[model samples]
Target: MKRSMVLVAVLVVLLGIYWLMQSNRPMTDPDRPFVQIDTAQVTSLRIESSTDTVELARRGDQWFLTKPLEFPTAARMTDQALGRLGEMRKLTLVTDRPDRFREFQVDDSTGVKVSVTDRKKTHTFYLGKTSPTAGTSYARLDGSKEVWEIAGNMTPAFKRPVRDWRDKTISEADREGFIKFTFVYPKETISATLVDSVWKVEAGAEKFDADKNQISRVTGLLSRMSGVDFADTLAADAFDAPECHLIAELALGETLDLRLIPKGEDGSQYFLRKAGAPTDYVIYKSTAEVLMRKAADLRPKPEKSAEAPPQKPRG
Candidate 1:
């Protein structure tokens, strides 16, 4: 019984020691430092890569891309970057010595740095273990020196303006004036004028039909001139096509030679002139629905002509 008691006591002591060691074991190694990021607080961000540079600004609860003044940032890209940054905050620092954290590199360089600034303070992060998948590389944030890894790929979240050019607004005063329509080709020139309810074409020789429905559409389009959306902006290659060039040349004037001059008391005078045209038509901008309308409106109204009196026949 004495021998058994001694063995039991030894076992109990050993178990206590084992329990103490297990309890005291560090979650992370002291030589390595782990970092966590709080992405929610990040208000604005700027990223520079070999191919492009992007700036992202936060407005209210939305994010916007400020550069290029055109393309808006994608929502998924913004959410992912923010989520990753937030996840960084959960990391625990395992190192007291900064030199031990030097093994990790961000952006494939010896030192990659990321500097995050909020309303109150700025925090810097470095890069550590990197797991690259597909075209993107993911790495641990070491210190500011290693941020370059993710910096190039980081995109800012931004609210972009709608690109519907058809819904733009135009001022009433703008419509009050006449808009001169002048069509000029290499060998031919055509001119038209728009007035309140009348459309004069062919230098006042012909009239155009101006009805209520036609005037509304033209006026509405002119008023809402918010401009074209970036995505709608014509691509260089598309414009470079021979057919496109021909279309543009035929549409817009080669020079400002073909002019639409708007004038009159209420700015209602529209004068259309081609480069060498002898005469111009003055009309209201709102009068013409299309070229055909101008032609119809220009038709001369019947005039009462003076006639010899009947008394002359009796005499």
Candidate 2:
């Protein structure tokens, strides 16, 4: 009787060890890609969550956001997401039970649904919380029972805010390529031209040297100007009476115009509209002040005269 009991104990231990090994092994074929789709053939991408949904459609080589109101998206941002999907590899099987989906944050209420459409079919998947280990995330196919531990931190690529997906660049130009800048105010106009590589300003036939440092700051800001956020409510006709108009003349004879329209009673906000662009943007108060410079603001400040040395007390 004692020998029979020892044999049963050994059998149970062996079974437990075997179960652990099988559970740790990779479930799916490691050679297979997690998402089998050619990124080049992709036509559209969409991400839906409980709070918001963002959709992007490809037009030839360019990509634009179609849902949540049509807007241009950053090419780099979209490209990175597509690349991640194309290169995803399943590391191991996390779970296969429907009841356990919520524990992994892969349920309908918590998971972020991502759909990638190509010419022939659309591939949909749900992305859950990232794994505690770096460079891994929980993912599951739309119709599959198995949940996977996929390589790469897929949360950032698939779960981005709407503002992060949209392009915020308001103006992009070469600073050195600017030859002249004209500021038009309600009552007067000022022109600053590059004379012999030095900045000179003309206000009502009065020509004088401009502050080179100030001119540098203005051109630098305009070269890579970006808005804090979009002004979706502002209409085109809202700029009927702009507080100031800035025209940047490039060396190639192209002009980039910006109109500043004040908002609110305290004038703490302004709508910035680029000439011929479909979208309007809002800039911070500090950025608006830089573009709203007048003739006097660009002129150099008067230097203080040096005081003479005091006479000696003996004299």
Candidate 3:
């Protein structure tokens, strides 16, 4: 009888331990205000950094550097930021009627305050304790202020997605085959055939090394193209402004004080004038064969070497 009683006690203890373990497991759909994010839904983002402010926002599936116009933003960088945000954990703690924007000072820095607005109208949270793992960090979010204290691999914090402007402008067909490129610098008129292999400048005599970096930069700019973002595209246009025109004219070896005009069958034509140049080179999209033929025609015909001298050498 005593042995049977002992067995019953052992079974009860095991059952109790199992119940406790199950209870400790994170509750997925608890009747609570806080929402959990899994860190992968984030795609594109934008980060602005300046002397007085730093702001981040995600857009599309990439990240953009909005502070300095010249700085390049990478997609991986955005992923890292989202990953960090996801690593934060939510503590069971809850606060009633969370304070909204109490102007709390961050890091004891004057004039630097973190004003978090719940744009999604979700539950407010305050940051709590943090637990970090090798590849992940678990942080607690205060249910009141919607604030979270995150601790984890912080290396991903600085990463961001690169802004692609031409995502909608250039079609797949446009990316294929050789295209016509006409650049008008101050005193030089430069034309290039963009082939699959290289940018044959001035009819293949002068080839510009289309290295990975150059191609990446060009592709990045093109990817950001969109009709709605005409201002940014137009600003980069080399023919619209006098300064750009002059830069183009002077930068390009050959220029006729003319601007470059791009004409395509798709009704994509633009007049590009050198910063100070008066003339422009009209460029139209042409097939690779046509460009090659044009270049061949322009090549100086082989000088009929003195036939007599050739005959004497043969004899």
For each candidate in turn, the TM-score is 0.31, 0.80, 0.32
| Model 1: lowest-lDDT 10 consecutive positions | 241-250
lDDT of each: 0.41, 0.87, 0.35
- Model 1 spans > 4 angstroms off: 1-37, 68-71, 89-104, 107-113, 126-129, 132-315
The digit string of per-residue lDDT tens for model 2 on 1-315 reads 999999999999999999987665444454778888989999999999878899999998888999887888988899899888876888888889999898777778989999999999999989888887555788899999989998777867878889878888988889999999999998999999998899889999888999988898889999999888888778658987899899999999889999998767787778899998768888887899998778778889988999999988994
Question: Largest lDDT belongs to which candidate?
Answer: 2
Best by TM-score: 2
- Across 98-175, the per-residue lDDT of candidate 1 in tens digits comes to 354445333424433445556766655443444242222224443332322332222222112232201221112244
Q: Write the per-residue lDDT of candidate 3 for residues 1-315, one digit (tens) a residue.
A: 999999999999999999987665554323332345444554333322123333344455454444434332444554545554454443433222234223321112211222222333322222222223233222223323333323343322532222331122321122222244453334444454556656554733454433333333333332232222112343344545331121111123432232333444463443333233222323222311122122333334455766554344453
Worst ten in a row by lDDT for model 2: 21-30
The per-residue C-alpha lDDT of model 3 at residue 197 equals: 57
Model 1, residue 234: displacement in angstroms?
2.5
lDDT of 3: 0.35
Better of 2 and 3 by lDDT: 2
